[model samples]
Every structure is written in C-alpha cells, then in structure tokens.
Target: MRRILLGAAMAAMLAAGGVAPAFAQGNPFQPLVYVNDSVVTRYELDQRMRFLQILRAPDGDRASAEQALIDDRLRLFAARQMGIAASDAQIDAGLAEFAGRANMDVEEFTRALAQAGVEQQTFRDFIAAGVVWRELVRQRLVPQVQVSDAELDQEMQRVIETPRITHVALSELIIPAPPGQEAQAMRLAESLVQSVRSEADFAAAARQHSATPSAENGGRLPWAPLENLPPSLRPIILSMQNGQISQPLTVEGAVVLFYLRDSRGTLRPGAKEQVLDYVRFRLASTAEANRIAALSDTCADLFVHARNLPPEQIQRQTLSQGQIPTAEAIRLAVLDDNESTIVSQGGSAEILMLCKRQSALLAGNAQEAPVPVTAEGEEGAAPDPDALPDREQMRGQIFSRKVGQAADNYLAELRANAIIRRP
Candidate 1:
C-alpha cells in the first residue's frame, strides 16, 4: 500500500512539473505517466485524449481514469490466475436481467451505460468472473466447509433479538511519523494526549489539532455500530460513560486520543436464558478440513435424534460445533457460527457442539418481560410506531441478510485460494 501511494505521490509531483504556464512552453513531448514496468504509451495517451474530446470528461478526469487503468492493470498482473470465467450466455442474461430490474428500456439503458463509461461486454465479463469464481470456491473449497449449528443459533439469536445500545462518537487528530521518525511520533502522541486531557475543551482541541477531515465537526466522528470499530477500540468504548473521554490508544502508525460526543446503538443489555437460549463455544483449531466435516456430519445425526433424548441426557449429550473435532473448521464451514446450534443426547459428537440449552422456560408469561406477543405467540416488544419496521421490511431484512452471508462465505473461500503479489 505504501509503495503504491508513494509512487503515485511521486508521479503527481512529476506531473506538476509541467504546470509552468502551458502558454509559455515550447512544444515538446513530456513524460506524462509512468508505471513500474513501462511508461504510458503515446498511442495510449492519444487514445485517452480522443476519448476525453468525445466524452467531454471533466478537467483531470481523463488523467484520473488513466491512472486508475494503470492501477487495475497492475492489480490484474499481480493476482493469481483465475479458474472462474462466466459464459457468454450467463453474462448476457445477467445484463438483460439487471437492466430490466432497473426499469430502464433498452435505449435508455444503453444511453446510461455510455454516460457511465460502462460497456455491456465489460459488465458481462465481471458477472461471468463472479460465477466462475463462486463455482471454484464451492468445488475446491466449500466441500471442506462446515457451519456449526452452535454458531448459527448464536448469530440468529443475536440478530433477531438485538440489545439496546448507546455509544459516544469521536474523531482524533494523529501526529504522523516520517521515515525513521518513531521517537518523534511517540513524543508528539504523548504530548497530544496530555494536552487534550488537561487544557482546552475536547472539541476545541480536536479542531486545532486533529488531522482528520472531521476537525470542523469538532472532532466528532459519525456514529458507528459497535462492531464497526476496531476490536481494540471496542472495550474502551464499552467502558466509557455517556460523555467521558479516553486516554491515548496506540493505533497502527499513530496514537489516537478519542473524546466521546454522543452515540446511539443496539445494546444487547443482557438476556434471561430460556428454551431459545443459544450458547457460544469458542473452538480449537485442529485437523481442519476433515475434522470439521466429521463434526458437522455427526451433529446432523444428533439433531435428528434430539427429540428422543431425556432432559438430563439432552443437556449432557448435546455438544456445540466448536467443541467437536475440527471445531474451528465447523465454525467456518457452517458459515453462520453465531446463529445455529447442534443438539443431541448420548452421542459421540454430541459434546462437541456449542449447545444452546433452551431452558424449558418461556419469555412472555412465566418470567414475563413486558413485550407485545403476536397472535401466533412470538414475544417481542411492540414498536412505538416511530420505531417499528413494516412487515415486508422486516422480512426483507432477514432475507437480504441470509443472501448476503451466503455471498460472503462463498467469497471468503475464493480469497483463501487467491495468490496476491504485493509488488
């Protein structure tokens, strides 16, 4: 990343050399752009110029496109060979379907495509690549994949039932370190943290010192879901009160001093374990692929026999996916470790699962929380009109989420096989 950016910055500097009044310059071919392997060809440069003339790109937009193309070429060269390739028919079908879905007539779609500099053929290739890659992932990778029922149930419970949460947002100004400047950077970081702690108001100090673009917003960062923050940042946030500030945290390349402004988020608050209880068992990594598969297969068998088990037997026998052989593999394979669980009694794989022993208790009446109960008896707090989601919307959210998870897990497998060359 540094190599790419530093090279670009250097290129930008070289490009600036030509800025000495174009009107006063004698006609000469300047070194317009350079890549590691070769300079941009005159023919290529002329083609871009012609494209600019015809397309009427904004000032420096053509240059931006050229630089982007160079970057793309470099990336392609550095990436491993792909076995994934979409067929012509598939690409065509996908394009047609997408255009139709967007409610654009053929001509209108064609015009819109031209405006975006997007060719139908290129779009087709992109879709085809995805189809091919997905197939590759399923074949060479996904067969080895397993999803622990334990993880799945855990996630589903978390999502379907969210905790009410609150947060305080903050922006921080970091002092940058030059090459061989670590000592100086630390000194600056310590000084900055101290000054922010002692002197002026957080907002004032933030505006004066923070290098982040949000300085004008008084160092106030946009509210983010707790999960969106870096894992290291999470505990600190959790430990904070409504309007408290934090000490300096060492982030990569810089020190961060954060001040909490305000936050609102889903807070799990806590739960009374019930019949629907989902337990999470963090697994150990061993004999990855085969072990996980065996665990999964075993869990499936146990789940089939769960109804026959006695109460005590069920509690003792059912194991989470994470507990079994290849437990980590089981977590990765099932793809929804947080939402699913496997349960069984008196089975060998039974104790391997992260079991959610849903106690024989119900949430509504026995230890009732004041929540609205549906006619079919799903207990939840009724929305206060302003807070409620429409029925269709709620359904859509779940569906979209399921679809998204499938896509992500599919991609993750492919990424594991990919060979990335940094240089």
Candidate 2:
C-alpha cells in the first residue's frame, strides 16, 4: 500500500521530467485502466512510475508504480463520493508545503520540476489527491481514536515497575512478505546482509530495499533498552556486538535483518527503576556558563536568578541513570548527589546537577518488584490528570497508526466492490 505523500509524488514526476506527450497519434490521454466509471490514463501511470524511480523505490518496478496509481484513483473517487474534493487553494497550500521541504518556494520548485521534465498540472493533481484523501481520513478516522486516562496510567505504571536492562542501538532493514513473494524477499535480505560491510552500506541498502516507513531514515531505530524489545529478538540482539549485522530473521509478514550500532546499560524510569534526581540548566553562551560558575556556590543557587524562567527551561526530574541517553551516561555518572557537570549535545551545552540517586539493583539482572493489583470490588486509584509529554506523544503516535490502518482497510473495501478493468 502506498502512503501517497504530495512531496514524493511531485518528486517522481519532476525526476522523470514530464511524460512524453507524443503518442501513436500525438495523443497522450489513453485509458490504461478503469475503476468503476473513473479512468486511469496511460500518461498518469508513466508519470507515477517516474516519480517512484526518483524515490529510489525497490527496482523502480513498473508493477508497483501502477498499483500505487490505481490506489490513488480509488482514493480520488472515494473523495468525490464523500463530497470532499480538495479545493484549488488546498492544492496550492500542499504544493507550497512540499516545496518548503526542499527549502524552495513553490515558484522555484515548480521551475525546477519543469526543468526535470514534470508538468506543473501533473504535480498539482498529485498534491490535490493527497490533500483530499488526508481530509477524508481526518474526518472519518481521527474521531474514532481514543486514549483513556486509565490506559495511560496503566502503561506508565508498567514502565516504572519494569527493571532496567542493557540497551542496544540498532538499525534494521525490513522487506515486505507479500504472500507468494516471501521467499524472494528473504533471499534478497540474506544477500544484502552478506554484502553490507559497514553502517553506510547497510543504510544505503535499507533506503533502496526496505519496505517499512523507517526506510526513509535508513532504518535507524531510536535508542531502546533490550527489555522493551520483542522477546523472540532479544536473545539474538544480545549475541551481536556493535557494528555487527545479523542474518535475516523472518517475522510476521516480513523478513528483517538488524545492525547493532552501539550498546549500553540503562535504567528505564517508568519501569520503577532506580530514580536519579537531577537539576538541569541549558546554556546558550560560554559567558553564561562562566557567570554561573563565578556566582553559584551550590546547585540550588545555579538557577536562583532564572527561577522565573519556564520550568522546562530548567526543570528537575528524578529519573533512572539507565534512562539517560547512552550518549550522556558517562558525563552524568561521574557526578555525585548535588554535584554538577556540563555536557554538550547537538551543539547545545547544558549543566546537569545530580540531586540524588537511589540504588534499586546492580547493573544487570534486576528483578521486578510486583505492583499490587486492587480487589475487584474496590474502585481503582484515579489516574493522574496530568500525563507526561512522552505519554502524550505516544498517544498521538497510536492515533496516527490507527488512522493509517483504517485508511488501508477502507481502501481495500473500495477495491473489493469497484469494477476494476485493465488493458
């Protein structure tokens, strides 16, 4: 299933230049297929294929591009049925947004795309379809997604109660398993693993071959503790060292290979691991750091002048050391309670004050301390009205995923009932 982004669709057309208008009789608008009464033209199919090519999709296969176009037509037809066609202004807005990604204005992007061979109208149509479908999904699917306070609290409690574990920084390549194509995908994945010698090579392979959304980022996963990983994959991860690639492992509906980038031990705070109380202050200039060093006698007074600033600008949190990102663990570890250290990440420097540290267990093999479940008749404790930012982000992520799945399922239903014809 293609997630039709306006930018990607536009890129395809621009990269391919415009489809040659000259046909058998100098006529380009030839019917390639029909979905019910709506038609997909040969010119449109060729343009989409070129778009997919510029995307560096697997093999730039014509069949896949054709399938994507067919789906786009279906999406457009559905939009009309719902009386929700995109306005011309909406299409322009989408085109402008897409151009912004390339740091270009719409006029500049349009000229560049034209030079590359894509027609302005073709790009506009692509943007219109995506814009309309997005509106349709927002109207139909978003209202159905709900994340209750109880659900958030239960998850938060679970995270706090789970013990800390060694974390592995990993990247993955996932090739889709489309029924009869499973064996072929596995063989390809195996070949990739054998040929990839470095992180760059693996990332390049992922961009060209992976079917997962993460392919856009070269399959890099966020830093995560091993305990949070799927049980079946954890053992295999533990066996591999940094920079090592794993053999292809088949999971439900896909074949996956992992590359271990780095590893570290961390405590997950929500799992109720040992909490490290710390004060953090962000620094913008060396002068600020120097001024603070000269004036502050203790960690408490370091932020005395900045107390009126936003709390998040200098907030204090009691968190697990294991919960600290692998990159900052070393700097934070060397400090004692109330002692402070300075570290810079992504060009921004910050000072960390170690307020307190509690030992729950050693570096490895920490056992879980069970949280008591209340009796069936008693009312459970009211969930905190204020959920963490991470919890809110997770909720949004879950909602988006549900909407995507609902869109796919809705499209499948449309395909099932429509009279689809191909020539």
Candidate 3:
C-alpha cells in the first residue's frame, strides 16, 4: 500500500514539480567498483541493484550487471571530458523528476527510497550519468551525426503511408519520461530495462508493482488502437514482441508504461524490418501520443507569444532531446502541450526556448520487415519473429542504426589507439 501510494505521489509530482523540505539523512559510504577516477562503491551499486530489481532483469543477464555500471562510468568519463555535468540544480530537478514518475511527493519519494534501502543520492548518481552522457554525446559525438532533409522527408513519407499495427505487450519494464524529478524516474526506468535484460521476468515485476493501473493485471495494458498511441511509441512497438516493454518517454503529466503484446499486419516483402525502441516519458495512460503532439504544437504557440518578453525573461530552454526537429519531426515528434515548447535537454515543462542547431542523432524513425534467411544451400528462410523489432510500433519506428554504427566505429578507434595490459 505504501509503495502504491508513493507511486501515486510520484506520478503527481511528475505533472507538477514541487517537493518538501529535505530531512537530515545519514551519511553514504558504501563503495563497490572504482571506474578510473570514479568509484562505484557497494552503497552505490546496492542502490543501483535495487533499482534494477524494479526493472526486472533476467537471470542470465544479472551477472553482467557490472558491465552496465562500467558502461555508465565510461559515459560519465566522456561527459566529464566534454565538461558536461548535471548541475546541482539539475540533480535536484532530476530527483524531483524521479519522484514524479513514481507519482509521489518529493518528500514521500525520499522516504520511499529510504524504505527501499536506497539513499536519495542513489537516484542522483544514476540520473546524473545519463544527463552527462547525453550532453557529452551531443557535444562530441553528435557533430559527426547528420540527417538529411531528404531522409526526414522519407521518414515522414513512411509515417504517412504505413498502416502497420497497435499494442505490443513487451516482456520488459517501461522506463519513464523526464519530469523535473526525471533522474529518479530514468534510473527506475533504465534499471527496469537492465533488469528485464538480465532476469527476463518483466511480467513478474509488473505484477508486483508497476504504477500503471495495468499493474493490477500484471502490467498488461490492453492493446492500444494503432491510432491511439503516440507515434513515438507506435513505431517502437512495431519491432518488439508480445511481451517486450518500451523505453521510457514523457508524454503528458505522467509517464506512460508499455509492454509489447502482439502485432497484426501484412508485412511487405523486400521492405526493411521495422525496428522500434518505444521511448516514452514516464506518465499515465490518459497521456496519449496526440497529447504529446498537442504539447509540441502548444510550445510553438508559446513561441509565438514569446515575442513580447525580455531576453532575460525568456526561459533558457533547449530541445528536450538536445535538437530541434525537422519539419518532418515537427509533424511526427511529440512536443510539450502547455507551452508549445520543444522538450528541452534540461527537461520540459517551462515556457520559451531558443531553437539552436539541431542534433542529427537524437530521435528518429526506421522500418524493416522480418526476413527469414538461411544458408545459401537451403531455401530462403521466412522472416522470423525473434529477429524482428516489435511490429506494433509500426510507422513511427526510428532506429538509430547510424548512432550504433558510430558507437561501433568509436570503439574500433579506441581499440586501435589504446595500449592494453593483459596478464
């Protein structure tokens, strides 16, 4: 009951960013592994582990948890190298964001963390890494990434023409969207992703305590009509399984959760497989894709009203994903409704923004049909479900194949340039 109530408060906070006074908490000192200059103490790892438990990791992947932490450290190191730190204010905001996703009061969330045997800072460290990582990538790596107007148009064409599917109940946990307290939410959401990857017990996790009402039925939200879900979620669902979950994204006031169920459509031949990673902000079912679209439109409306405000009075807003959308993205991307503001990298829910240069590797779209292939000697295999992305996400599917290519290229360069000591 407490967990449920705290979750409820967290959701409310996500909609409105406000918290109580901080109480004196105990000192934190547990240490685990040291990543270069940084140390992931047992205390930190324990909190991380707790969060992962919430994510519902698979048993096979549980042992590899350390790798995820290491990757986070690597990203942290990069963020630092790029001088991108998630500021003090950002940390507070992130904590608030977490509480919001959980749907609790900040103070309530603080207490919940305490009850969970997690320190408040547990969320801080987790969220800070993501903040810094994204900032660093946008600064150092994003420069090398690019999306052509033609490509955007092509994606738009696909979104307009494709008639794929709806609801896909994934066998995973739903990551939440950004609220002022988004840090906690992201960690919760990301940890769920990691947990599902490790333990492969998503439904169990959902049943135990998913904040969504669907938790009552084990995180099983009924199949959303294809037209009802946001384009972002819809496309991502296309490539997932009947039990695959979505990555988190902020829709309206609450974080929307997803578990891919099943898809229905006549997959085309020779078409690229539609691979989607449904990214949703942690919010509620009432918050739909159209709501996000309406929010984006609202932000534009706010911008029109911004003509009268003093420069200092203007909100120092950045695109939530660190880039402006193309005309196609504007049409397809979910924007904040209240102010018509582009979701900012600093996070959303404010008025006014300066649209600077957009990043190419931010959010995107992709499409592929399952292709069954076998050895040259054998008959060409029919497309396999296991190899395909969730088909339920359908037309809005955007897989950053390029970013992956970039990451791979980056790693290759690192291996080529590094000096290794093998004992």
Candidate 4:
C-alpha cells in the first residue's frame, strides 16, 4: 500500500508547472470532509479522482480517492511535525527519476500527460506530498528495521533446499466484476485478449483498461518465480510460451488476462552454456548515440560516458545466452570483447558492449564452477559471508514493507482520534 501510494505520488511529480482554476473569491473551496483542522475541499477530491485515473490506481473511484486524499492529509500532517519536506532540488531530481521510467525527460513526459488530459500541477503536488512522506517514513522507520544474519542464512538455506523452478516475465490486464457483472467482465476480458495481437497493443489496452496498480506501468510485472504465483495460476503459466496471451481467468471478483512475456528455468539440468558479462548503454537521444560512437574506443570508455547519464540509462549484468533477448542475443553472440552492438526499443537506442565470456555448467549439472564469467583477478576469491549479494536489496524491501504496515496502522489510529466530519 505504501509502495502504491509512493508510485501515485511520484506520478504527481511528472510535471511541475500549471494551475487549476480556483473557486470564485467570494466562496472558498467548498469542504467535503474535515481531517482534524485540515479540510478536504470538493475541488481537491475531484482533482484526486483525476490524479488516481492517471496513476491507473486499482479500485480507484470517488470513495477510494477520498480515502487516499485523507491519508495524504494525515501523512502531510505527520511530515509537518517531523519537519520533513522535499527541497526544490529534491523535487526536480524526483521528477527526473519518474520521467526516466517512461524513457522520457520532464518536458516530454509533461507534454505526454497534457495530451492525455492530465494537468501539470496535479502531478507536482502529488509528488511533493509523496516525497515528504517518504522522507518522514525513512527517518522515522528505517533506522529501527533490521535483518539479522540468521535471517539471511535462513533465506539462503531455503533457496538451496527448494527444488529448481522456472521464473516468468508477465504483463496483465484485469477487469473488475461486481456481483452481477461477472459475465460482462469475462466477455470484456475475452474481447480485449482477442484484439491485442502484439505486446504494444496489450500494453495500450492495459494502460486504458486494467483495474490494477500495474496498469500505470503497462501491466508489466517483475520476473516472478513460479512458486511465488498463486496455485491456480501455476498450471496456466506453465502452459504458456513467450508472447502468448491467456484466456480470461476468473479469480475472486476480477477477470484477468496474463501475457507471457518470457520465461526461463533456474536449473537447466545438463545444459552447458557460455555466460557473458556486458554493459548496455541506453542513450537518451540519437545525438548522444552519435557522440558515443565517435568517442568510445573500448568497452570501458562507455563508463566514462555513463558518468553523464542517469543510472537507469545504463545496465551492466552477467547473463547466459538464454537470458538475453533474442535479437540482441544474436548480435552479442558474434561480438568480440570490447565490441559493441546497437538496438532500439521504445524510441531509445541501446549500445551493448561485450566485456567477458566463460563457459559454465548450469545449476542442475554435475559440474560446478564458482564464477559464471568475470575478469581475471576478480575471480578465485572465496565467497565473503559479509558481502552477500542482494543483501541491501533485501533489507530495503523488508524495510519498505515494515514502513508501509506501520504507516497503515498509524493512519488508522490517526483517523480514529481525529475529528473527521462530512461537512
């Protein structure tokens, strides 16, 4: 819930200028509800409703919008007590980060939103409140959250003891079904699935239609491990191939369409494959691409250029051939060390530079190699117990979850104590 709120708030920061027409001076904005001393105006509620629409907020409606606005009021109230608010620089940086997700700059994203009928100030205010709330949560909660070494060991042990499983990349479109609208929702899902022939089409439909928070991200979900998916979904997911879209899946009160983007096995049994280490530089514009093409001589030189780009514009990873996207993988297969290849996706061009390569037996294979692929001197070291991979990521996830839960509970208490009245 906290993450969802943060995403909504961050979306608010996409544009920083513009103003909504104010109520006539004789009458202040008419109050809809009061949160202690703070009153929520009808105008604010209407603005929040539109804001939620842009966020593709799941279960979004006037009621949810009202609750969300009330919660934000509570959050801002708390932030005031803590003296936590976003600075002008922090807000600009947040705007840049949010725009990056859409492969755009602030001006570009704002222009896109304007075309979609969303005002600039709505995003700005949403982001400002969200930024301040995040700081408040971090300052108050993160220091108190801890993951013991034992906890990490237990998680690692679980991974080792569990059987090898496949993970999948997925996109989804969901339609909500009210008590009597089940058949209607199913029909809608069916129609949508039949019409969406390509991934871009599916994403477009999801952006306009899905009743889930992921709709804002074109229904894209992370690489979800099979075991982590619902029991009923496992069989359906297992039967899907890349680019396949599922039939309408009726679950609880929603009709869903899951698009299988990609999938891979964790243990390839007896498979032996050459793994490669590479850096993919995603340039912001063709101009940047031309500049890099002229100046870059070695794969290492890309990092020098990266210093001027946002971190999301660059990717460095080690992956087996199967893990690379088909077209890019084919290009990588022929590239020598320090050689680079270019490809375009979503209007951005990516330059992939091969760094190193090594052969390794997969997890289920009898042969074992400590390192997949690495430069000399980087390999041969015993694993450091203190330097656990994804430790910080795990800590951050856990901390965020705790903060979210704590915030939920705190907000509930605040509502209970506050003199809330429908005016």
Candidate 5:
C-alpha cells in the first residue's frame, strides 16, 4: 500500500510536468548512489532537486540536492540504529503542519507541489526524516544540555549593560553605473574596496569618482542614526570596524561603498525603543492587586490568580516602549521581569506584571533603526520583524543554538564513519 502511494505520488508529479523531459528519458528507478546498505535512486534525486527549486532555495543546485539527500539518508540510518522511527500519524501531522505554513491543508499542498514537479512522497520523506531526527536528538542530546543560573545571570547582565549604538559617522562613495556601464562601475568599486584602506583613501576615491553631491566633501556625512540609513545597510554599517571600508554594493544605477568613521552608543533615550511583553490583571481593589503581586513570581503565575475571573479582566500585551502610555511606561521601566506594579485604570486597580523587555532593534521593529540607504541615495530593503526574547527565552535560544551546533558535529562524525559511495 505504501509503495503504491509513493509511486502514484511520483507519477502525479511527472504527469503534472514536475520533471524535465531529459530526466524522464532515463530509467527513474536506476540506483545512482549508495549509503551503507541503502540506495538513492535517480528518481529521488530528480524529485529532491525539483522540491528544492519549488522552495526557492538559494543553493538548490544538483550538488546541493545530492548532498541533502545523502544527509537525510544518514539521519534516517542513525534513527533506525537507535530504534527511533516516525509513525504514520506523526508524518501525517507533520505534513499538515508544514502545509499550514502556506495556508493550505495536506491535499492542497500536495497539489501545489505536484504543480511545481515535486512528488508527495518527496515531501513526506523530507518531513519524516526531520521528525525522526528531532525525536532522536531529544532522547539522546537533550539530556546532555545544561544551563546554570550563574550563566543566565551573566547573560542577563551583559544584555542590560550593552550600550545601544544610536549614531554612526560614515563616509560614502557612489560610482555611477549607467545601463551599459554596470560591469565597469562594479569592477571600479571592487578595486576601490581593496585599495581604499583609510579615511583619506576613501575620501580621495570619493572625491575622484563619486557622483553624489557629498563627494565634494570627500563623501563625508555627519553622524546619523542607523535609522536614517536604509534598513539593509544598518547591519552592514554596524558590522564594520572603525576605519573599515564596505564591500562594493550594487544599486540600480550605481555601485556604492562606505567607510565607517565612528559609532556611538547611548543608554538614555534609547531605552524608550525597547519592546515589552507584560500581563495586566484587573483587580477590584489595590489590596487584592498587591496580594496577587506578592503571590506571583512570574507572569504565568498570574493566571492562577485570574482563574476565577473573566478572561477580559486579564490581558497580555506586547508593545514597543514608545507605544506605551507615559505613566505606564514609567512604571514598567523600573520593574524587572515578573515584577509587578499597581496602576489605577478607570477607578479600578490593575496589576501589571512585566514578562520581558527586549531591545527594539533585536525585536526588529525599532523606528529609530530605519531601512538601509546606499550612498547613491537609493532606498534599500527593510529588515524583517523578529521578536526579541526575554531572559528565559534568551537562555532557551542559547541552549538551542548550542544543541544545534553539537548536532551538526555529531552528524559530521556519522558521515565520516559511514560508507557513502556513488554507483
């Protein structure tokens, strides 16, 4: 039954024009590579490549597809050795959940993939491998992960003390690349990136070749907040060390470069840009609010106090510092996570429990950090919105990153020991 489903899925993909005629001309079931005792068929390779293309992966070439399949095989083999297997139900749920990302159900997602020349079995295989690997890692590696309180405290302190960069000094140069001159402009910009080592060198180059009006001042620009630059350029500018020149950036009609003069950080008004997540529980009196506050150690504990109350009486909100009302912001600014403050709202007492505070920049919604702008005066792409986690969440993030690195290393070891070969 499973074989029939897999074949039908592959045939659907082919009939829907998923595979190219050249790929279809060959025997699709021919074994092309071997991993230990398992074989990777030519059909699977073609399916995997088509799937990657549909996903619009940047490195979705034949080599990347082959390597990915090999890795999946190794992961599955490891799972089998450990007696970790993904059940049919888990795979079905995984398929549904993955399809939900595209606002579709499993059947709809399958049809969409078929339209793009990807088989349902290819998608199922991908999800099953991932599910099995996750279960395996949870059982094997999660027990090895440990985070201490002192480490959490140190990380929290570092986050609190790190000054936010509010302003930067930069020198810019834009080389005009007209329709027919783009390659020439890019070459010139690349050359300048290598040769321009100092502020003087950048200024000289800017004055010599720059087309912007700022070129008259050796491309010198006054200190500006990253917000004033394009969203795409903020990280680039922040990444540059003092006196470092940026790589050549191609714009529509120009190739641009920047020299970082200096950057300054501030702790004051910059604090207002932070994003706060908190819970507000309405109480009948100040006394009740105080009692609840005293009993609760975290935002989750507030739910216990509100168990008998209406849902509307308890509200959770995530808002930027600037969006918060002045009085509320003042009270919250002084409170740490899980700490509470009683504020009067409509003659009733409300307990505001701080859940977490994160930098707006890290949260990816700071108005102060504007989109990126090139020296050519063109607006660049905006930054994607990201939620910045609080202390506990940060700890989890750190742990996850560490675990991921460890898993990668483990996988590398497995690959090293396995007998992988081309047929």
Candidate 6:
C-alpha cells in the first residue's frame, strides 16, 4: 500500500518534470536505498539535492542528500509506527511559513523551485517529515525532561562569571519630528548620514541636532556589550567600520542614526560587571500591554496586573548581561528602571521593563569595584534570592538541551536496529 502511494507521488512528480532533463534518459524511480521497508528513490535524491542547492546549503552534495533522505525515511517510519502523521493543513501551513522566511508565498516559492528543477512535492514532503517527527519527539521524549533549581542556579552563576567577549562604542543622533515633520527629519538624518565621515563630525552633528540626553556629551555612549544592543541593530552595528555612520532608522516620532567609534574584544581592564533585573509582560493586545506598562513602576507592581492571567504571561528575572535573550537584552539596555517598551511579535505584544541595573566587580578581583548603582544612579540594593522570578526561562533552556540529546539518541537507536540497505 505504501509503495503504491509512493509510486503515485513519484509519477506525479515525474510528469511535472521533477527530475532535470539531464536525468531524464534513465529510470528516475529506481530504488537507491531502503530504510526497513521504505525505499529512497533516485528521483527523490535528485530532487532533494537540487532543493538543497537552491537553499545554498554547504553540504548540498550527493552524500549529504542521500543521508538526509535516509534520515527522513527513518523519521517518517518512526512517526507512522507511533501513529503520528502531519495533516494536510499542517503541512500547508508549514510550507507557507517556510516560504515566508524567504519573503515569498507558497505558490511563488514553488515557481522559484520549479525554475531550479525541484518539484513542489519535494518541498511538501520535506516539511511533512519535519512536522511529523517533531510531534513524535514531543510526545515520546519531552515528557521525561526536567530541570531542577540547583541546575538553574549553576547556569546563572556560570553566566555571571563569563566575561563578555565583545563591546562596541557608538555615538548617536536623534532628530525629533513633531507630529507633522517626519519626512523633514528623515531627510535631514539621511543628509547627515551621507556627510558624516568621522567621530568628530558625528559628535558635532549630535551635539547640534540630537534630542537624546547624550547629546550634551556629544552623543557619545559608553561602550556596550554587543549582545546588549537590539537584535535587529547588532548585525548593522557589526557591519560598520570604525567611524562609519549608519543609515537613518525611524523610531517612534523620530529618526535616529548611529556612528560606530570602535569595536573591541573584552573590556578594558577593571571594567565593572553589569547585571540586569527586568520583567516581561506578554499580552494579547497593544492596549493591554500599554495599560500594564503604565500601571507598573516596579517589577513587583506587575504582579497585580498578572493576578488573573496565566503564570507564563508575566516573567521577572535577574540575570547577568549574557543570560538575557539578545532581542530582550537590546530593549532592556535602553530602558530606565520602571520604564517599559512594547514590542510586537507574532500576533502578540510584549511589554519589557527594566526593574534595576546593578554594576559590581567580581569578588576578590584585584581592581577596586565601584559602588553598584541603579539605572537612576542611586546605590542599588541586593536582589532577594527568595523573590527571584520564576525559573521558566532557565527551565525551558534545559528542556531544549535534553530534548535535542534525546532526539539524537533515539535516531541513533532507530538506525542501529533498523534494516538499512544500499543498492
């Protein structure tokens, strides 16, 4: 029954020119290998290799293609044995989502693939295999994973002890556009971006036209860890050479620009270590997110708003700079304690607030440490360990690691026990 369905699928693919003209002279349906009772066809291998090549995968060669197909077969077989299958709707959604990554719809993506001699079924099968295998893994292995508080504490300690590897120094210029002058602001920013050539030039422009408080310091910012910048801005900052100006970036009611003064490895000797305490509030609507942000001045204040909500929707954590996710780290970096920013992601909005920032030297380090200060420059208090936020983030990380290891072990076991043959 499976062979019959496979043959029909391959026949449709062949009719649609799944195999390139170069392979048309031979029987593309010939079996090259088998996983248990499942066959991996020559036509399938060719399609996969072509697809990988279109994706610019480094290992798009024949050996990689064959192994990938064999693994796909094993995954599908395992899924079937576990009575797990991807529905047509799920597969279609996956295809659409995958295509969206390349900024194309599924039909357009398929057309592009066809132009490169890969069939639509090749893409569909690939997504379906992944979807089914993920479901299988979740059901079979995810339930057994656990991360204890001890592990979380150790991970937190390790993150704090790890020194940041890279930091960037930057200057900024922000041009405020009162309700009606956005275009004028952007044009002015663009002109400055083109004219600015050196740190001195940037400083002059920043001191003259920038609205940010740093303008008084010639818009110069203290050296910041690369991870501390917004995820979207990090790559752009890294790509700039020293003394290069950035293209104008539009922010709410303003146009902003940055000048890269320097990027360096490690901090200058005796730099104070920075730690963050922040809260994340995930809400279904921007209005709700705004309301919560307005109502809360401290991380603890958010608990009132979260009382009726799911525990997962609101999180407060104290973490070293390296422990925060890049995107959140970027947002938190710019926020003053008790100030919040609403970020929209995937049909929901997150209100991220910085509750406190503490700067301290590692214990026993020879360099004298500066007194820890909050975002407002007041002496900061020690974070209460008992009041630490839920450990869901750390728990999720440990769960992912365990699930990945389990998946690899499970696949290996399946491969060892299965009857795999190459012709």
Q: Please list the Cα RMSD from the true structure of every candidate, rounded to 1 decimal place.
A: 16.0, 21.9, 24.3, 23.2, 15.7, 22.5
Q: Kindly state the number of residue pairs that clash in model 3.
A: 108
User: All candidates' TM-scores?
Assistant: 0.32, 0.48, 0.40, 0.46, 0.48, 0.48
Error of 1 at 8 (Å): 31
Cα lDDT tens digits, model 2, 309-417, are 7777686776576677775567667877677776665556677777765544322223333334578755566543222236666556666777889889988998898
Per-residue lDDT of model 1, residues 150-258, tens digit only: 4444444454355445444655555554444534554454455455552246777667766777777777677777768877677777776655656555445554667
When summed lDDT is taken over every stretch of 10 residues in candidate 4, the lowest stretch is: 360-369
Q: Go through the candidates in order and give each one's C-alpha lDDT.
A: 0.45, 0.69, 0.49, 0.70, 0.78, 0.76
Residue 278, model 4: Cα distance from true site in angstroms: 47
Question: Considering TM-score, which of the candidate structures 1 and 2 is the better prediction for this target?
Answer: 2
In candidate 5, which residue ranges exceed 4 Å CA deviation?
A: 1-25, 157-162, 165-389
Candidates, ranked, lDDT? 5, 6, 4, 2, 3, 1
lDDT of residue 30 for candidate 3: 50
lDDT of 4 by residue, 284-361 (tens): 665667678578777778888889668888888888888988977888889887777767666677888898654433
lDDT of 5 by residue, 320-393 (tens): 88788898899999999789889876657999989987756545522323568999989897643321236567
In model 1, the Cα lDDT at residue 62 comes to 53
- The model with the greater lDDT, 1 or 4, is 4
Task: Give the clashing pairs for model 4.
Answer: 12-123
Model 2: per-residue Cα lDDT at residue 159: 45
Lowest summed lDDT across 10 adjacent residues in model 6 is found at: 1-10
Worst 10 residues of 3 by lDDT: 275-284
Q: Pick the lDDT winner.
A: 5
